[model samples]
Target: MPHPAAEHSAQETVPQAAPPPAPLPAPAPSLYDPPELNPGAWQRAGRRLLAKTIAEFAYEEILVPVRRPTTASSPVTDAPVHRAAAHENPSDPYAEYTLALDAPGERGAPREPGAPTGGGTLSGPGTPSVHGAPDRHGGATGSVGTGALPSRDGAGEPRDRAERPHLSFRARRSAYGHWEVEPDSLLLVEDGAAPAPFTDPLGFLTRARTVLGLDGATLGHLVRELSATLAADARLEHTGLPGSALAELDYAHLEGHQTGHPWIVLNKGRMGFSASDAARWAPEGRTEARLPWIAVRSALATYRGVPGLDTAEQLYARELDAPVRESFDAALRDRGLEPTAYLYLPVHPWQWDGTVLPLFAASVAAQDIVPLPSDGDHRLPQQSIRTFLNVSRPERHTVKLPLSILNTLVWRGLPTRRTVAAPAVTAWVHGLRDADPFLSEECRVVLLGEVASVAVEHPLYDGLDEVPYQYKELLGAIWREPLGSRLDAGERARTLASLIHVDPAGRAFVAELVRRSGLAPEVWLRRLFSALLPPLLRFLYRYGTVFSPHGENAIVVFDEQDVPVRLAVKDFVDDVNLSAQALPEHEGMPEDVRRVLLTESPDFLPQFIHSGLFVGVFRYLAPLFREQLGVDDAVFWSLVRSEVLTHQARFPELKERYELFDLLTPRIDRLCLNRNRLHLDGYRDRSERPHAAVHGTVPNPLHAL
Candidate 1:
């Protein structure tokens, strides 16, 4: 079969004359109504989000729910009983918990003197009341659960049914003190009233605002973000395919099916995107778009690339065809400007019209920034809304552009300093892998380098001190090495995030892959760990470096039979971090790379893997595996712990490094993702991007193993 790029190029070469412009279509009688917004879809999305809200909030110690004694009877009379585990072992991780909501304008029940005021006292068996003291058996263990609930009204009498609303559900505390709440098990009971399924995320948030410590302003913005997220979730639910079908998709198409960041409750809170914008540009939109190019004057634009792609011309030569280059030059020459005086880069259509035209009007008027027609390659947005994969030419570089919308946590924009230093950072990280025998030969880990970048500085914003970080990151483009060109023959790649994805029918993508591989679930899981952990472990212990191997940033490569084989990682400049203490491995690092990569102390350096992969990705994956594949959560965690130990044993000579960058510590700092948005950042614009909130420590499962 002819290559797709060849077909595209041949078609472009034979193009004759431009067609005449056509009139705009007539307006429809009614506005488009999205099918995904039906009540059924919303309720499903809401129930999931509500469960996530409760789980994440409880995990972060923001809303501590009191543990309730589990009885054989269902919490809700009509609702089906859901148990995390089938057997009722005394040491079983699952437990029942309840959170009470006071009536509007009424204060919570009075607390005993010296007891905590908000929730209550932690007095439940096997539930952790204090930080870093989780049960060794992979459950919350403590005799004293301080979180006590109020069953009575403020007038010291039992409140009416409607006046006393409380939520009850069964949840299991997994590794890293993670909470996995059974969404179907959640119920809202009002004293004398019959219990009903709790499916309203907004109502839950509104009712528990005081308990959650959310101020009015933050609560208002949070509600908006949550609603936006639910809408996106509904769309995914409406269109989601079964795992069997998803397993057959290519990397680019598979990305559209993924539910966003697993750890974030409001994962799709694209603050600046309208419904139309989302349909046109969101990853789940699954529409291919040709991004229009822009020419920024040399004075304001800076280009950076690795050794072979040292010049803008070199990058353009590889990224744009001759015809596209000539057309760009013709556009500049027609305006009486030299093409050499400008740097050409693609701009997202929405960003071009919404952000650039409005904010950088002065530059456009002065012809310092001139818009050019698209290079004519159709690209699909990946999980990261701002990144695009060129479907027209799969071998071409994937482009990451600045998008001034808030999602997950920060504005999805490339920072000026990091954008300019991307190539340098990539080169340094790639150099480390290339020089190491294990990474280069044995493991064969693929580092998808950000080979080139064009940083366009906003004239006024660049000069201003303490300007909003989003303004400083207004316009930039990073060209990353494509995944298609890096994989071995018969090897396919999927984002690590996809493994945790559960199809609307409750089938896990991992289970599908495992079944197709013809391997026992445990064997497939071991293969997954073996493929993922070694490279990451080497980077932290041997090289004193770590990449945030979070779901979105890491890609797992599978062989023809669907067995995981190797790892591919991207987003070098933003997600990579290094050790604060100087090591021999740092000797080859360039000054620019050193300045760009953030450094942490040796003690905290491992958090990138501990939090990013173990907690961020695997925390959720473990539960899904247990539920769908019947792999015990403890066994799943043990597999992960064994991988780390195996890697450590393989590098006995670097035993000292292992101690410095310890992964088997008794406790690890709890990095809170949802808490950052709810309590810390809360839609507020700051000069710098916000970091994850560090709450109390969580017991490390690896230590127990």
Candidate 2:
């Protein structure tokens, strides 16, 4: 049973003859004529674009202080919430901070009146109105919110108390709780303060244009989103105000309270924050509380909506919106929401990636490079373009894909063939059209390598060259898959669990996933959670309340048993937030340290916990199992929680050693409490909801009361 051949294909480097390869076509004469790939261009552009984008968020999401919090104690870096004050009066001057109203309506009027509000509706059928707090089923407690359920400042404690800074804004939880801010958003600087316009709107907009290479309309959309955030802030302060003119008010200031609200909690499998009420609580970060990537990606998607950029992809791309509400609704109906919560959030937050590179290549690259595609879809269409560096390598169809399928994707259009010395070489290549400018370099490489398929008795080695690089770029680009790839999707995903490096069980588990799934789509997940397994269950981590999980990225493949046999995960668009790179503690942990250090980013995990697991796996995947398997929902979450805890009990060393998991335990509980009940007042009123001024029509978007 020991297969020496089981060694990963990447490690098998046998010296052989290097076959002569066909000459590559000349590079295009124009349009980035500089033959150099300028891969650095991506970094530079990405940096500049990021700064400008940050600038766009300057007043909205970005918090700048004239000085450190007068009261913040040193050493504790966590963003501290305002503590309770001895003298408490809800009607005091310090209680009038800004908060955005929940923008109204069901999905009916896709087009907001006049200019667009940069807000999209995510409410489902028969949504109850907010009384003071919000109530409905499937809602989770936490700052991110449950539905468009209400909860805000004072829901916790006092945040900041100041004379109306002449700038106040309102932020409402769009259907799935992706916060939408208003551009040209007003500000209320107390009675005497001056509400100034954003000083650097153009500077911000231009920078976004350069970094993202966005067209006019895309840029415009971003600006609108920016403005909306500002406006929403204004609305929040204005709506809550009950004071006199500037002359009458001196030290009188508003100190909004949202102290009691927990930032995260687990609801069944879904993650919810203060979904409904933003104006009262979480105003400082209200404008852009969406799943980190969703906020940006939605902006990009909207940018493509602008005319004249000559970008039709985003204009036509169908996006899944609002898995939060969808999941909640499904929960009510005894059904499961679709499997992609991160991909389907209802609100259209700002986005930029889709308008750029991988956004376009998602399908093209995916279809072209995927060998088996899925289980039975092995007879893939040759139409999927293949790019090759040289014909000396084997064609994708002829190559032994093994685990390299992922590598091929990372080093897209690169070679996979392992080379030795070439005694006699013969290969033909032609696809890099000079004048015709036919295919992307990606295509040219794959096509030419396919041609090299001829004249090599070593049929396998013939296409080796092109395959390795492609495999490296695509698959080797990241670390988690390789780690997970080595495990079995089924048989209790806990085989290696956290023992990926120290224990042989970990290695064996990795081997199974690698062999069976081969980096396919959603297949691994199904295989992972069928039973009480650690590594299998650990694979289900999803984060935060954004509705949709990233789709163009994560992929899975199931075998003949209709379970995940091969799986691959892609896209770190939100890697900055979700990755574990920041936690230096992670590097010392078990598993592939180099891969984790070199490829895995810690930033993405915080975000992933919010986006991928909270929305994707918890909200999406678990429900899928409940529906398909016909099981109770809470039992599913309880089972997994029990397994993880039980495992921790079994291995005390793991609890002491893996600090990451140490930080992981209680988060699910915190996220589940009061997350759904947040509203205008400090405590929630789940018993009573808003009653519309008019019975026939739905409650006004701002106040169902």
Candidate with best TM-score: 1
What is the per-residue lDDT of model 2 for residues 1-705, given as tens digits with 9 covering 90 to 100? 546676655468788899989899998675322211234433332232222232222111111111112343532111222311201111112111232212222111222111111121121223222211234222321121111112222123232333212123322221111222232343323334475433233333342232122334434544544343333223332332222121121110111201111112110110111222222123222221222111112211112111221232231132212443343334323422232221111111111122112332443233211111111111110100111011121111121111111110121122211111100010101111212222222111111111111110122332345432322212100001111222344312111111111111112222333344454323344344332133222322211111112222333333344343332322221121223334332333323212222222222232333333433234333333333334344454455445456655655644433344332432221111111221121121222222211001111111110
Query: RMSD per prediction, one decimal?
Result: 13.0, 30.3
Whole-structure CA lDDT of model 2: 0.24
Q: Find the 10 residues in a row with the least total lDDT in model 1.
A: 78-87
Instruction: Please provide, for model 1 over 298-415, each residue's C-alpha lDDT reduced to its tens digit, 9 standing for 90 to 100.
Output: 9999999999999999999999999999999999999999999999999988888878999999999999999999999999999899999999999999999989999999998888
Error of 2 at 589 (Å): 13
lDDT of predicted model 1? 0.82
Query: Whose lDDT is greatest here?
Result: 1
Task: Give the Å error, residue 597, model 1.
Answer: 1.0
